[model samples]
Target: MFTFPILAVHKVIARGEADAAANGGFRNPWYGTRPRQGEKPGLWLVGDEGIYIISNGELAGGQKPLVFYSDECHPKGDTDWWDYKHRHFGGDDGIEFIDADLLVPSFDRNFGITHPGIRLTENDISFSLITR
Candidate 1:
């Protein structure tokens, strides 16, 4: 399986009432505790091809996120990219947060210009594709 790193750019807040319906109100499991302010959470993307970041107008609303393959910047070396994997993800593969909007960047594009959205519920976060 091919593995890629997924980073959540933004802070996660509590969705208050919607906590129970989300992904079991689970916080990011990668860190022992919640990340400090301005800290971006990350996960590993493991699949045959790759993953896609989608979004609607709102945060974490609209459609569920989807994964697909692309001929983009797929870094698979033991450099800073690999170091990031080891540092944030313990060198393993996985996925997290709530209430807050998640800025997920496309594997091929620059995050500043284009990023998908994910809404954080108390329990879970869902992905939506953003159209330019």
Candidate 2:
């Protein structure tokens, strides 16, 4: 499995975008295509905690995306996971691509507690971790 320092998460996003741009524009790997017309933006959690924010599609394996209070710890219960998923993703399990635009607020509200380096903006998000 691929493991990245939490701070390096933004590189993952940049690399994904670079790959898509080089290929022929933006195609979400998870969906294998650009989002369908009218699809709302979504976000996905990277690093050790793999969560997602999907704007459209069907959920498989009961895997709902979530924005957590901290990535330092995993979700303690199903309620925390599902609640975030439902609130942000409208309970849609069918999301393919996590929207780039939504990364900042989502990370700040969820994972920022532990990873203060999680910074977001309209253009990009930056992340870093403090090693204890």
Q: Candidate 2 has which clashing residue pairs, if any?
A: 7-128, 42-99, 56-94, 57-94, 58-93, 58-94, 59-93
How close is each model in CA RMSD to the real structure?
A: 12.4, 10.5
Which portions of model 1 miss their true places by more than 4 Å? 1-79, 101-132
In model 1, state the lDDT of residue 106: 43
lDDT comparing candidate 2 with the true structure? 0.40
**Candidate 2 weakest ten by summed lDDT:** 47-56
Candidate with top lDDT is 2
Which stretches of model 2 miss by more than 4 angstroms?
1-6, 28-35, 38-96, 105-132
TM-score versus the correct structure, for each prediction: 0.23, 0.32
Per-residue lDDT for 1-132 in model 2, tens only?
112243444444554444444444433435544564423333354322223322232333563422333342234543455554444333444323445554445455565333333433335555544443
